[model samples]
Target: MPPAQNTAGPGREVLTSDDIDRALRRIAHEILEANKGPEHLVLLGIPTRGAHLARRLADALERVEGTEVPVGSLDVTMYRDDLRSQPTRAVEPTVVPPGGVDDKVVVLVDDVLYSGRTVRAALDALSDLGRPRAVRLAVLVDRGHRELPVRADYVGKNLPTSTAERVMVRLAEHDGEGTEGVRIAGPAEVAP
Candidate 1:
């Protein structure tokens, strides 16, 4: 395929819509295989785009297993360690499934896995909610920075990048139509 243009604004498209779909499908299959089917599986996406991705994954899982999988949004804003340093962000709602997270395999999904702080915050938030039998992390883009020692259990794409470069994930459900792809912008190209 030809290199994608930055119709979403600036930056070069690294993963097209088709690529993202394929990655999600593969991740869904991997999750099913790892857990030996979707039994007791709960998908909790970190809010904003993560929630949308979780719903998509649930849909994919339903297609494969012919059964519905519980999916919800997890807001980790309050649990973040850098709240004092970074600007305050609006805390989205945290919606757990009917049965809650207790004794289930919880999968936390997100768009970009960058400094690992968000995942760490998510771990803290998940603890406040309930203890799961197991917890796994899934990310659409894994940009290696690693301020913490966290890693994704299922990754859609491993896009190695410098600290100065930014990986942006735009989903139609959250970012509007015709802007559904992963883009990478260097220091000079990134929007302020």
Candidate 2:
């Protein structure tokens, strides 16, 4: 398929809607397999798109396991280290599922994984809530450019590119209908 235009100028569609659906389904199965039946498992999305993805993953998990999974949103705004340097962002609501995070296997979900700072902030934010038996990271895209020591345990797509480029994920759940795909914008080459 031809590359689609992104708002940030010339870009290419990395993952179509079908591709995203397949990837999420696969990630759902992987999550179930890794956690072994979803018992005591909690998925916390990092607001915006991640929250939507979490809900989708929970739905997929329910389809396979025939059991409901607890999913919620975790906002890491105040915990972000770059708050001083970047533009100020309003703090989003952090919702934890019933039973809390204590003793549960918590999975932090995000739309893209670039610099590890966000995950690090998430860890800090999560700690303030409650202690979990374990914490894991899941991302729809892992665009390599690590500024901190962080890695996603579950990734949908690994698109390596220079820091100059941007990975834009537009989900219908967040960006409205007909805008569902992952795109790379700016001048950068995707590593093989």
Candidate 3:
């Protein structure tokens, strides 16, 4: 798929930076509370947008819990089947640490939770990395309609969208220069 753009259509802003900050703060509290601490928790973001979200979440978690969290990014472009439907060019590179994921609590972060295909691909990509003791997921927006049984452990927001609508997530890390958050566009306005 082409990189998601920063634009507006209908409906209000489902998630703004303020919204994202609040969500991250809350999720950080939840993660610390559930995991007992930030120790042994390795955060891996599904590349492109997910990696960016993961970094933000890691910082929040670190600030809230006073622990250093290792954050990494994984690119699952090769694992995706819709290369033809993607942009004219392929996606960015996938990078993982040499240490591997042995017996670590992996929290996968992503921007928009759509059909769960990306999460599925991430799982496949992760298998080659190594064995993590357990895997968890954190999505900025959960837009329902999952093609896979995948679910996020920490969700910032839950949005109900139609098949005709498009959900776009913009992160300052990716969009850069002062743009961020998530928005949805009408079917006709987006490339089908």
Best-fitting candidate, measured by TM-score? 1
- Which residue pairs come into collision in candidate 1? none
Q: Pick the candidate with the highest lDDT.
A: 1
Model 1 lDDT tens row, 11-71: 8889999999999999999999999999999999998999999999999999999989999
What is the lDDT ranking, best to worst? 1, 2, 3
Stretches of candidate 1 exceeding 4 Å from the true structure: 1-6
Q: TM-score per candidate, in order?
A: 0.95, 0.92, 0.87
> Where does the lowest 10-residue lDDT sum fall in candidate 1?
4-13
**Candidate 3, which segments miss by more than 4 Å at Cα?**
1-11, 84-89
Greater lDDT among 1 and 2 belongs to 1
Segments in model 2 whose C-alpha atoms lie over 4 Å from true places: 1-10, 187-192
| CA lDDT, candidate 2, residue 170 | 88
How close to the true structure is residue 68 of candidate 2, measured as C-alpha lDDT? 94
lDDT of 1 at 176: 88
